[model samples]
Target: MQRKFACFGGSFDPPHFGHLRIIESVLNAKEIDKLFLVPNFLNPFKSHFYFSPKLRLEWLRILCKESLKVWADKIEILDYEVRQNAPIPTYQTLQFIQQTYSLTPKDKMYLLVGADNVESLHKWQNFDWLQNNVEFVIIPRKGFRIPQNFQTLPFCAMDISSTQIRNKLACSDFVELSRLIPQPILELILKEINCKKIDKK
Candidate 1:
């Protein structure tokens, strides 16, 4: 049987507890055989704000190591988006995965996103192409409503975000964030932050 996969793409400037929770939830739900945690090389919309792809990939690797789920694949980090200097469109990434993984009509490929993105789906580049090619698994975000056209899955509304975690780290208040991320990933984040501070000095 062909393995079904769900692709969750983001800059993941700092992998937070919320992201790990979503991955665990999705995996435990058995919605897909495998999950691809795709970290963008450069996000077009959020280009002004993001960490280097190398750092983001490193953080993701640490998160994966800490995750109990073994089915999550880091294939997205190795994707063309990371290789190309230019911004990679989401539809293009989906197409490449489809061809590379030999995904068939019977084999499902879900584009996992947060509820906030679901509401703004129409604004995404090649939105029509995305709707035609892949199904979606949306995790609820605080204060975001489910769209009418898309089917909402039963997922926890994770209130944490990478931005919030970064802000906390900036203030040296990683205690709350520590509770969110796995110990291994939290240690890595702390180490990276300290290294950056030392370099700045």
Candidate 2:
């Protein structure tokens, strides 16, 4: 039997509630049996990160452990890109997963992408191979166009963002921060919130 898996990669600078909701949505998806959370050492799309890659990875693990306890066995925290200690493309990550798990040609995995990245899909590294091998699951965002080829799940998409949380942390806005961040790692992030400086771009 082919095991269905999904990959949701992001910078996850602080692993907020928004990230958790996405994970829950994808895991609840009937088509996905397992989900992998890939935290970027540095998001290739931008320059500089607000927190260290190690810290981000740790926060992700904690988020999964506390909030996602129900999915302990169903979720995995991938450290491949973080281990690389640099910005790594999605194609490489997927390739590694494919080889590591011995997924045959017939065994296809799902790749979660934001709707904003839909139009520029071909600009991605090895777009053809990605489109052919794995199913592209679109996380709907208003004002962005989703292609017919991409799969859409009944995800409870939240409007929260890491950028907003970063601002809140900078200003020590605990009231709002408490609501935006995941309960498990909220204090963990506040403890060393100044680990690194970022552009907030």
The top-ranked prediction according to lDDT is: 2
Per-model TM-score on C-alpha atoms = 0.88, 0.92
Candidate 2 residue lDDT tens string, 60-86: 998888898988988989999999988
Q: For model 1, what is the error of residue 126's alpha carbon versus the real structure, in angstroms, after optimal superposition?
A: 1.5
Most TM-score-accurate candidate? 2
Off by over 4 Å in 2: 194-201
* Model 1 agreement with the true structure over 117-196: per-residue lDDT tens digits: 77567888999988887888777888988777765656768778877777777787867877766787778778877788
Q: List the residue pairs that clash in candidate 1.
A: none
Cα-based lDDT for every prediction: 0.75, 0.84
